[model samples]
Target: MSYQLQDLLYLMQRLRSPEGGCPWDRAQNFASIVPHTLEEVYEVVDAIEREDWGHLKGELGDLFFQVIFYAQLAQEEGRFDFHDILDALVVKLLRRHPHVFPNAELYQSLEAAPPVSMEEVGQLWEAIKHTERAEEAPHQPTRHLADIPTSLPGLTRARKLQKRAAQVGFDWPDPSGVLDKIEEEIQELRAAIASGRQAEIQDEMGDLLFAQVNLCRHLKVDPEQALRSTNRKFERRFDFIEQQVQSAGGDWTRFSLQALDAWWRAAKEQEKKHE
Candidate 1:
């Protein structure tokens, strides 16, 4: 396909048109297509992990389709079409990267402009978001860290909320301090449990996880990303175990706990050898 950036919006519209196009595409709405978008995102990550360019190419196309698919649906409903969406983003990109875009203060190299610190970059990004939203609709001036969507998965949202708050000096000074706070929260939870206070226990549990996420954030580690990577590693290791069991003429379900443990050890050893 001879796809160009300027023609992309028109392409998405044609894809969803009822006259002659994809039936699955024609039936989808923004709400109904959300899960597919999310699934495509994971597929992209999987491709990255596997280090397969061909896989990445396919997965990225799938992800790109999700965006276009949503935009097409919006056009069908008389909402802003894909071009409006693209134009808004293009404007935002130019506005945000003042260092790179012409008409802003020039740097020695394009890479060396402003936002010297990570915090400064974050401030600049948020400031642009606030400005854009205000222009779109007034009364959204106060952009709080916890304003992130509640519909996001709790663990993912927790990490994001903690990082957002920390960007504004609302965090422990060091990892050790966060570690100590985690223990304190745990102790408080225990006391709450002893007192039969369900609410207090639930609140303290959140505090504990938030503290841990803060430490992860400060250490330059994304807790959600770390967990997802480990989950992927575990899945690969377990799949290896399954393959090993099958090669030995053994059914995975028929294997005893000891047998599984032995296979797991072998997998670990193989991983270590590769390292």
Candidate 2:
């Protein structure tokens, strides 16, 4: 709490330095430490969902270290440092939020605002990307849906790609159409199964998941977070069932399909009632 942001970043970088520092930290690089970044994001989500402010504070600190770690590595390579990164973000934030800080009179309210459609807004974001790229390289926004990091988890990346494509009117209009597409994809997946071709089945499975991601967009839901919540829900309920069975001197391996189904249904009902 006493340290400023820069001071904390400095401390973290020092901790990762070669001389008299953490071995695990010093061994890490951008690509090698990706799972830590992903795990920290999930920890932040967990803390927020549980409303644990103390845990959130700790998780946020860990996440901050991840960023600073990357900056430190870049600093060593003379690519950029934390200060440069900070200055770039500050400039971009001020540019995007002209309505709040600057005297620049942006479109008056939502209604009085300059009638820039979503299509135009996407173009504006692209413009900003172009400006950033120019600063880094003389790069242009060659494609409408370009530059999304491939390293992103498939589900999240799929949603972002779908949203980007929708900006160019490449998306279905309604949830009904999305649902129908999902059914079509499911049929294709079943056919792939019947065909018994491994490569075709993999491709069909990817298509099915991609269709589901688009359906999530049409329904105005976050596919990745929805899937993660389902995972946690099952984890909690199954753990509860396991505990109860042990308390009653029952072995988990001895559970029949019907018995487990009954427990699972009870868990679902309990979850609904608690909510």
lDDT of the candidates, in the order given: 0.78, 0.82
Instruction: Report the Cα lDDT for candidate 2.
Output: 0.82
Task: Write one digit per residue (lDDT tens) for candidate 2, span 8-42.
Answer: 77787788878888998888888997899999998
Specify the highest-lDDT model's number: 2
Clash pairs for candidate 2: none
Best by TM-score: 2
